[model samples]
Target: MDWNELAMELQKEVSGQVLTREPMARHTTWRVGGPADLLVIPDTIKDLSATFSFAADHALPVTVLGRGSNVLVRDGGIRGIVVKMFRGLTSMTIIGEDVVAEAGCYLPFLARAAAVHGLSGLEFAAGIPGTVGGAVVMNAGAHGDSMGDVLVQVEVMDSSGNLTRVPAGLLQLGYRTSRLMDTGETVVKVYLRLRRDEPVEIRKRMQANLARRRALQPLNMPNAGSVFKNPANASAGQLIDRCGAKGLTVGGAAVSEKHANFIVNKGRATATDIITLMEMVRRIVWDTFQVHLEPEIHIMGEG
Candidate 1:
């Protein structure tokens, strides 16, 4: 019934690492978050399912985390059990012309795998900093391509710890959003259908995308990729730039001058600072262009 009793039981049934009061800041991309009361990393699907079953049975709140690329956690920290899928769940297999990858497998690695196998269509993910599971949930994309374009089917584990393979049609994926976005189910595996292309051409395209990202993004700084989604046919960065809000700062958080949509942590930036800056940018863009900007990054925990 107590926290330690539950954790010890979890340690016995789950084949993964478990830590108490783990700092979530170490897990997120922005490098700013409070502690998680409990954190568990499951290596494989079976372990994940076991963890979930335990949580369900014990009535403990559960939060799933992938690579923590597009998320920000507040200073008050997250309560309950935080499950992170990594390493053990990282496996990719080529099945004929399709690729079956585990949830924890990094996006860029999947892109590289596709290129090596002469599979086209994942080139857009070459520099993405997320995992397969996160990409599917958010329909993450770049250069006019997204996970929905090539995803055929995915294996997901529900809150009850039941694994189900669902078709892409059931996912309701569209423009950086998916039905899975709010669903509590955890993506355990993903299957992608891609066309055969010359490896040389695939490599060339991947390299080009990577180069473009490096040139545009403040890759040197700690920040979530894109703070806001593109509005209609207009770019969020362009709108922010036009408003002269670029380089706007609140505490240690500042809107990236390299690309206005990104807000980087200048070092020791708190969640409140980023939130304040985002609010300012949104208000400025709305006032000037009459366009409402929505956040792309997931903000969690409490300040």
Candidate 2:
């Protein structure tokens, strides 16, 4: 379908905001991407369902982005529609000892809310960036803890528009990976089960984590969290650091001196620059230690 005709049809079906040819750089953390042909932010769950149906009816490709934290969109623009869950789709409530958060809610927001309510299990996620949907799909974690540990259940919409609530046990979460990540399904919401702890203690723990993050990570610059996953029985950052990659640079992308696994955008780095630097790290690590480093960050779009 043509852009105008498709826009009219979507507007008639759902009362949500839609923007044409939106620059994807503004949406991602990396701050280096082209544009999305169509960007749709559905106001509610029903609106999201309708948008999914619209895409299916027109046979248009759709990408569901959360807070756009982990993705590295390529230089070439994305074709078709980009569906984002933010704004009205975000809703949180207390369910027994657990909190049910909509996909759009940011992880830090939820962590603060949980701390305020004396919920202890989520303290580890206080420094984690991204939305609940992205966190669940990636099994996002920090300080040696992951969302997979606190997640009780999650609701997802498959490619055919089938929504299902799967228990935590069925999610098959591993180190930085999950079934959702492999399938590319849209995560609607999550029900997390946390323990009740003393509010003062929870706050203290969260504060400590935040301090450590600031001291160790290069938060002053723009970069994806960790560039590579740690190989079994070895630390990726330590390996890279020992291999003299700490001062490495390619165009505007540089390997962070503070933490070796992080590649910071020193200035106006292209996606190609980041890719080249990542390859250099891989080659150096493999040649030095006979260990292949796998990237943990998700790289998307056409290069």
Candidate 3:
């Protein structure tokens, strides 16, 4: 598709970094992926819109990513254009009892900011490793509180680069799914309504959440967080553990002994290894419990 030529044209169209055959491994948390045909890291909203406009003009496919958590890019990498939103759109402000954050703001950092501002609702997000855009799109949650609970509204860019403000209710946020996932809209900013609380108490709660995550999750390893979603009233991890799937390995990917829901890269793991291990665990859990486990993490790109 003459990706180098497209990269040069895209660079001229937007004030952002444009590269061809950029390594996807460096962008994802799992640290394993092939090279993207074209990648753009926008410096501003205008840059993002221009990049999208360029893609549209070229009739190219587009993929948007932020923080790269809870996502696995395949070993063949992604085709067309990849827009990375992290590090470019991270601006946050506290307004009265609400917090307005840009899409790329780190979720953990936003949680800490809310605590510092004596806000109460985001304490559960202290341990989540993702960005506001990705979290809102996926309805990400921890400790029984999801992004749907506190979100007020969001600014999103359509595939054609048109911007609009959408209320939280319109997002159809439910159980780690959102309308944005289906619509292919790119979230730009998020508005969250939080209650005022004692700063000391908020910090205490955040600390507790972080401690629990540290004790339960495989935080030291390279992984895309939980592999499977909990089915209806049952925990996915408990089911997998009961099926004796922990420590199961396929190449460099293994089900984390510390957390059955996680598949960690021991070292030199490929996307194929992770996907193979995930299917194996899914089959074992389904065979034993008769529950069809669904993936929680987003799988992207070609095999």
Assess every candidate by TM-score. Answer: 0.97, 0.96, 0.98
Model 3, span 142-209: residue lDDT tens: 89899999999999999888999999999999999999999999999999999999999999989998
As a whole number from 0 to 100, the lDDT of residue 57 in candidate 2 is: 86
lDDT of 1 at 124: 95
Tens digits of per-residue lDDT for model 1, 113-203:
8899999999999988989999999999999899999999999989877889999999999988998877888999999999999999999
Candidate 1, position 66, lDDT: 90
Per-candidate local distance difference test? 0.90, 0.87, 0.92
Best by TM-score: 3
Query: Which window of 10 residues has the lowest lDDT sum in candidate 2?
Result: 1-10
Q: After superposition, how far is residue 84 of candidate 3 from its true place, in Å?
A: 0.9
Worst 10 residues of 3 by lDDT: 8-17
User: How would the candidate models be sorted by lDDT, starting from the highest?
Assistant: 3, 1, 2
Higher-scoring candidate on TM-score, 1 or 3: 3
* Steric clash pairs (candidate 1): 43-88
lDDT of 2 by residue, 1-303 (tens): 367667777888777887777788878877887888778888787878888888888888998888788888888867788887766478999755789999999899999999999889888888878889989988998888999889999998887778899998988998998998778678898999999889899999999999999999999998879989989999999999999999799998999999998998887988889999999999999999999999998888778
At residue 18, candidate 2 shows an lDDT of 76
